[model samples]
Target: MNVAGARENVGSLVVHQSGIQCFNCKEFEHFAKECRKPKRVKDSAYHKEKMLLCKQAEQGVPLQAEQYDWLADTDEDIDEHELEAHYSYMGKIQEVPTADTCTNSEPLE
Candidate 1:
């Protein structure tokens, strides 16, 4: 789709990184956008990245540490290792006694 813009969209440009692999051609050293090979049928799941890793293996590229959706990278993995901590914090907050909590009290001797 043609998006009207001043000159071009800067974020769309992917920088060249030797470790980056293309999902389209399953080739290393390029973005899928720069891939010259015909696109394979893209999948909604990570099946493509898995195949991409196979290519990475043949080319001696180390497996990617994590397969992150480029668009959602910022929001994803927010509680990856901290889910328990987050749940404990919420539980502690729920246990807190508010000002309205009734308490049994008598005049202290």
Candidate 2:
């Protein structure tokens, strides 16, 4: 092959290997990975804001509902004091059953 033809082939191979292409900016014959743009916090902030806006757009509607469902069966017979006493008595007590107290006994599966 001619020297100029060989050089062109080599250049093509280099470009393919480097994964370089330009769509937005033409000054650098490469993609965003090889971009020369100055790093800015605003760029990341813009992306975050864009994501939040997209999410809000997805969930556009607000929902409203009653705190308690009136149609559901309500238990009014159990008083608050009785329930509090039952729970408090349970908290103060630890029941070690007398039958299981033996250390030499084999554990029943």
Candidate 3:
């Protein structure tokens, strides 16, 4: 006749009526797995910057001028010029294949 004792006897697999809280929003009434809130997104740029800093620290050398500039500039100042410079600098660092390097193509007729 005791519902609480009967529920306890039934086992812990049964969801409790209270004390459940969502990890996402830290709210009550729902478990984290059942939370309706959207998952948090990771900041890829921040992580990449951190990784670069770690690499620099391991090498015991200061960051390149462009990287130093990038780190010093605020997010709001990332205009077209800054982006172009970043891309150009990256291009200089990485070697890209040109038409002359293509070995699979026939000569022009």
Q: How far is each candidate from the true structure, as Cα RMSD in Å?
A: 18.4, 26.8, 18.7
The whole-model lDDT of each prediction reads 0.49, 0.39, 0.51
TM-scores of all predicted structures: 0.28, 0.18, 0.25
Q: Write the per-residue lDDT of candidate 2 for residues 14-90, one digit (tens) a residue.
A: 32323333322433334433457643232333334334444455687332111012112234686676456545554
Off by over 4 Å in 2: 1-76, 96-109
lDDT of 3 at 104: 63
Candidate 3 local lDDT, 4-90, one digit each (tens): 532223364754535554434557655445668874332444434544665686788775433454344355555676566555544
Using TM-score as the measure, name the better of candidate 1 and candidate 2.
1
Best of the candidates, TM-score: 1
Best by lDDT: 3
- What is the Cα-based TM-score of model 3? 0.25
Query: Cα miss at 74, model 3 (Å)?
Result: 30
